[model samples]
Target: MAEIIGVIEQLWRYPVKSTGGERLDSVEVDERGLAGDRLYAVRDSAGKLGSGKNTRRFRRMDGLLRLSSRLGHRLDGPELFDPLGRPVADPTAFLRAYLQRPDVALAREDAVSHFDQLPVSVLTTATLDWVRGAAPAAVVDVRRFRPNILLRTPPGTPPFVEDGWFGREGGGGARLAFVRASERCAMTTVAQPGLPHAPEILKAIIQAHEGRLDALAEVVTPGRLSVGDELSLN
Candidate 1:
């Protein structure tokens, strides 16, 4: 049985790992995920990958959260976006200053783009709302969590509904097989652009859902996904 629950709220891609990401009206989903998602990252001289999760390596990836990455249909045509949605020309040097490491270099994920778990991650407005209720003091920005797909659940849907989608087929344009609940990491607590540092964010997730906030999936049959599209769970 297939169920239609909601519309796609937003499609997000983080060109550079741990940095900011841009929203898309539509995107082509491939085996590696959205064409340009997490395809590039900032690497250090020691070959350590830069990520909000790998704080020991960069020490300030949270600041990178203030910077966002964007790209056109072509992979080579990548750009960085500021908080105000303005394009930035020199993301390397700009990110280096925030990280305070002159040796850090931008490299594609081919070497190390910083993927934590599965290729695709999804979250729902219901879960976000529940977390907000759990942690009113901390800012509950979805950017802090960095999910690849965001779905706006139907009205009155219960929180943590993503867990129910496991083992089900999902997506409108792109067909995906839900795998498991994505485990939360320290990265969620880091400060992202427009969001301040709030360690309690992770605490809310742990207390509410045992440290899992979203569902992870893999492409079953590659296709495209777009905002306002309807995803079905079967």
Candidate 2:
């Protein structure tokens, strides 16, 4: 028998990598993960995707988080918007001017994945409360963590409860298998709209929790999921 753990509080989909995403009341989940999630990205001259930290496949591109993107009716890609909510007519030119990188351009994800790690990322309200308690002075917001699914656990539920779900399958409609704890990065400290520059947010996770705050997951059964759906461990 499966045990009920929590209800889905929010769903997020990032059409463009390393940018702000849109909240949804409901969304479709596929084998690739959330539909339209990270289908596009800012690519540099060296072919590295834009990200918060420099890696083998990712290049640290500052100010990418200030941008927001959403999936339009087009199947080709999502529509990019600037920090001020204005639509971008030319993504390549806009990205070049915005990031001050002459060789940077917008591109879609190909055979290689655009995700930082796993296909999905999950966070719980209990962990948020823990972070707030740990760093009372820091502004702890869900946007800083950038989870694809936000679960609202019942009262009295312990923080970091998602850690136990690793190697377990759970979801409301779309089945997901928790794989590993999502690692924190320097991106969490970057200031964005309605968020302030707070490095202490990442510091609290590192000092108290070893820099992990959420769960990274992979889709086991593709389906539709909605806010308020009950989640259980199977």
Candidate 3:
């Protein structure tokens, strides 16, 4: 029997990197990803992708981003706010705020522009447990992974092994489609504050879970999602 789970969860579109993400009760999905997901990004002084990928060059970005959003009418054009909860700026003041920190440096601020690895990342609680059981030393947390959707499935259900291919109905009757599995990198090794010390959690997941613990999906087709939308396999 195919079981259908109600609306799982909703994550807000966090445009900035490193700071914090906003949670939402409902949201609209789009092709690029959630309406506001990765809408903005940071660059090194020399205009390089300022993300965890090249931590040595932009390690300051590790804990410097802040993102938030509010209710809006259209999913295609929903407005995004800075970490301060202010409207998006013309040149984007958020980057300046991030660069002011001493830990951050500039090779050429205008020369780099790095987007997040994925527009919106999603993971499941079951997946976390699976990794934990396989690698006792691994301590997986949603924040460390920085996923946008954290669906809670049945206890016996498997982890989010194939999130890239799953789809569900939104409360507003929109359909969310899974696009592809997420490819991991070295950044996963970095520690998130307050989480247990499992420096190799990312490596552990790659070793045990067929080298994948999370997947990246997009709203290939626009849809509305609520807190309790039914989850369906594609």
Candidate 4:
């Protein structure tokens, strides 16, 4: 039987990748995932979605880009801006400014937009602990995983076990069950703000553990979630 360990401790939303994220008091989930999570993304002129791979050519795309979120009554709604502000129509310009890339500014149509993935990427505390134990050198920041939700699960369990969770909890709140373990990419290996040797540490953990150092769960239902909300399972 599955067990409810703890409520979600941290909720994060990254309007864009590589850029910093905002901690949420609460968040809404839609069919995709977290709302305002990856609503828009920068696609190249050829209409290919940008992945962290092949950084040799698209080096600018690998760096952090900033974004904000605003809650609208509907899915196709206006986004709330973070303290840093939102990217207007020309995202490439904003990307150039954010990362100081003159040649790469406004390079695409949705250059400064969110991706189409579910807005929320949820992770459990148990997963965090498991990772911490495996990779002590890992800074373990949410940005490393780009997750929208930082959930707390049962202790001692490895990351991604939540891939099997389903249905509403015993209490009353909605449940965004786990669908599958997120397949990680080279991005997890990038060095970032709090972590300098991120790639080396992630490689070590992957060797000692199983695959990547962390896991992500998808929200199955569509609704709003707050930080202090209680979570339980039967």
Q: Pick by lDDT: which candidate is best? A: 2
The clash tally of candidate 2 reads 0
- Residue 75: error of model 4 in Å? 8.4
> For each predicted model, how many residue pairs clash, with residues at least 3 apart or on different chains?
2, 0, 16, 23
Rank the candidate models, highest lDDT first.
Answer: 2, 1, 3, 4
Please provide, for model 1 over 162-184, each residue's C-alpha lDDT reduced to its tens digit, 9 standing for 90 to 100.
88888788778989988898888
Cα lDDT listed for each candidate: 0.80, 0.90, 0.54, 0.53
| Candidate 1, position 35, lDDT | 82
Please identify which of the two predictions, 1 or 4, would achieve the higher TM-score against the true structure: 1
After superposition, candidate 4 runs with Cα above 4 Å error: 1-3, 54-60, 65-91, 96-120, 154-172, 212-218
lDDT of 2 at 102: 97
Model 1 vs. true fold: TM: 0.89
Could you tell me the lDDT of residue 85 within candidate 2? 87
lDDT of 3 by residue, 118-168 (tens): 455657767867766766766665666667777776768676645535453
TM-scores, each model vs. reference: 0.89, 0.97, 0.67, 0.68
User: How do the residues 1-234 of candidate 2 rate in per-residue lDDT, one tens digit apiece?
Assistant: 999989999999999999999889988999999988998999988899999999999999989889999884455777889999899999889999999999988898887789989999989999989988987888888999999999999999999998999999988899999999978998999998888899988988999888987999999999999999999998
Candidate 1 or 3, higher lDDT?
1
Worst 10 residues of 3 by lDDT: 102-111
